[model samples]
Target: MATITSAAPAATSDDRFFMRMAIVIAFTIVAGFALNFAMGRSTIAARPLVHVHGLVFMGWVILFLTQVRLATGGSLAQHRRLGRIAAGWVCVLVVMGLAITVDVTMRGGTPFFFLPQHFLIANPMTMLCFVALTTAAIRMRRRSDWHKRLNLCATISIIGPGVGRLLPLPLMVPYSFDIVIFVSLLFPAAGMIHDWRQSGQVHRAWVWGALAIFLIVPTSQIIARSPVGDMIYAAVTQGHPGEKVPGLEFPPSPMPE
Candidate 1:
């Protein structure tokens, strides 16, 4: 299987910069399937929430790539200006994330490929991690080293849904969600090794950020099947959507044409 990795021993600045770009570009390509869905390729219609979610996610991709280009070109003034805008936009992303998670679960858009409660829990956890890491990155903006690494950590956090969609992650596998999570780890794993190789130590930003991103997996598995999970599932998904969509079993969806 092919793999993604960060800089090797004594890699140049250009190498590190392009590695970061590759990470985001890879995510964008994986998630590009959403465009198909939007164009009527998928049965799921593009409702308001779905449209907003797509816009927000796509906006972040553009902002991330553009910011990387700006920083690499020494356009610090322009980058900071856009960074401020991106920071505010990050808040929108988080709010929309939470809203869509609840909305999807409530409406039974939680895929047949996932345990409903776990889906709800894991989906929002990514945003929580994103908000924390991105906020930390912004606070440490003057410390360019920490800022850059943490920003990488934060941007990669949202790659989970993309990875899950691209991979053939059916609900049948006993560890399907785990598989999605493990594939997603390639992002931070690359960053972790990059940090270690470059500085002879893993940056604490990557350490903490990777912890935040990775921990949600086991935590969801643990929490979503517990009493807490029952209450959460019971509360958010009610009546029709809840009954129509079983929490643990796969439901029929439109087969591809």
Candidate 2:
């Protein structure tokens, strides 16, 4: 009886915490894209491929929220079913994302706000990070310590674009993307703090996830501007967008707030 009663509270608390986190992720994604797309601020609407990419990503957001809701509601059976489906769905998402990245690089349709080279490196990296983390999360599903945090990190990984739109990326100029990436850390930071307060130490999943995000910024920044980067950019944009746009200039300038 004692064990059952104590376990009940712990289970309830876990559900509450996870449910609230899911809400945060869902709201952030939906609201960010709604503002960007509805306002015609994001250049994604201009191209058919980009439009499809948007739909696929939005589907992931909805699926993620649904899975979280199902698990928290104690519908583990339904959640596992959805998890199987998501395995296939996530593959589609990653493929669509990479395809769009290639399309943008070749066509030079990158938002005038971003340097084509930076877009080439950074965009794909985000997808790769998300894929790796999510794969680990799925594999370690039996270990809730790793499962939840890794999944959250993976989902949050790709939100940089949406976040970039929400913030005044232009106002920051050279450090624009970096600022948005940093701000996005708050979500994971909350998780880390929760883990600390609850367990007296941060979980390995949070540490790994946070380390990946922390490393991404500096690593991409360096490579995006190097000679090798220049060579890749030249090849990808041969007679393409880079030729037309200076790759680093804000000539098309961000719009007024």
Candidate 3:
């Protein structure tokens, strides 16, 4: 009885910590996009596809916050039921994310700081990583600690878009994508540190999940600079406006504001 009583407080504390982390991540995403809109970098006037993409992406953030609240509020059955809806939602996110990347690239809308080829390849790779981590978290749902950490990491995976918007990416040039990816890791890194302080060791899920997210940096560079990547890029941009823009080189920066 004493052991149960002692452990309950710790579990409650952990739940609060994770709930806080989820809010921070969701805010980072919302703030990033909001920053872009404030600077005239994004708009509702974008194409229909872009509007759909934004709505779907925002939907995931909302659903994640809902799940975190549901779980923390001790509504596990509600959490699990909503988790099923989230599963389908992520699939839509992946598809919309990739489709928009392709659409933007073909239209020569790839950000000036990013090589079109790298942008094309990296977005899909990141989406795949998100799916992989999320799937693992769902599978480990019975293991609450593993489930929460993995899901948190998975959500972190998609924040690159948000983080990039917040950074002076044009100034970063060749390293912009990698830098955004690295900064995004801080969220999971914080979780690892918190776990170590509270439990005397970091969880294995954080190590593996962070590794998966971090690898996108070098893996994206290697593939984007490779012959196979060139072929894929050429095939994608052939006869399109993107063809006029070099896949391996950054586009000319917009004039100073």
C-alpha lDDT score of every prediction, in listed order: 0.74, 0.80, 0.92
Worst 10 residues of 3 by lDDT: 248-257
Residue pairs with clashing backbones, model 3: none
Per-residue C-alpha lDDT of model 3 across residues 1-257, encoded as one tens digit per residue: 99999989888889889999999999999999999999897878888999999999999999999999999876899999999999999999999999999888888889888888999899988998999999999999999889989999999999998998889888898889999999999998999889988889999999999999999888888998999889988888888998888898888878675
Which has the better TM-score: candidate 1, or candidate 3?
Answer: 3
Error of 3 at 45 (Å): 1.3
The sequence of per-residue lDDT tens digits that candidate 2 reaches over residues 20-42 is 98788778878887888777767
lDDT of 2 at 251: 49
Task: Report the error of model 2 at residue 165, Å.
Answer: 1.9
Candidate 1, which segments miss by more than 4 Å at Cα? 1-45, 252-257
All candidates: TM-score? 0.83, 0.90, 0.97
Residue pairs with backbone overlap in model 1: none
- Which stretches of candidate 2 lie above 4 Å from their native place? 1-4, 42-45, 248-251, 254-257
At residue 218, candidate 1 shows an lDDT of 77
After aligning candidate 1 to the native by TM-score, how far in Å is the CA of 24 from where it should be? 4.2
Against the true structure, whose TM-score is highest?
Answer: 3
lDDT of 3 at 133: 99
lDDT of 3 at 239: 88
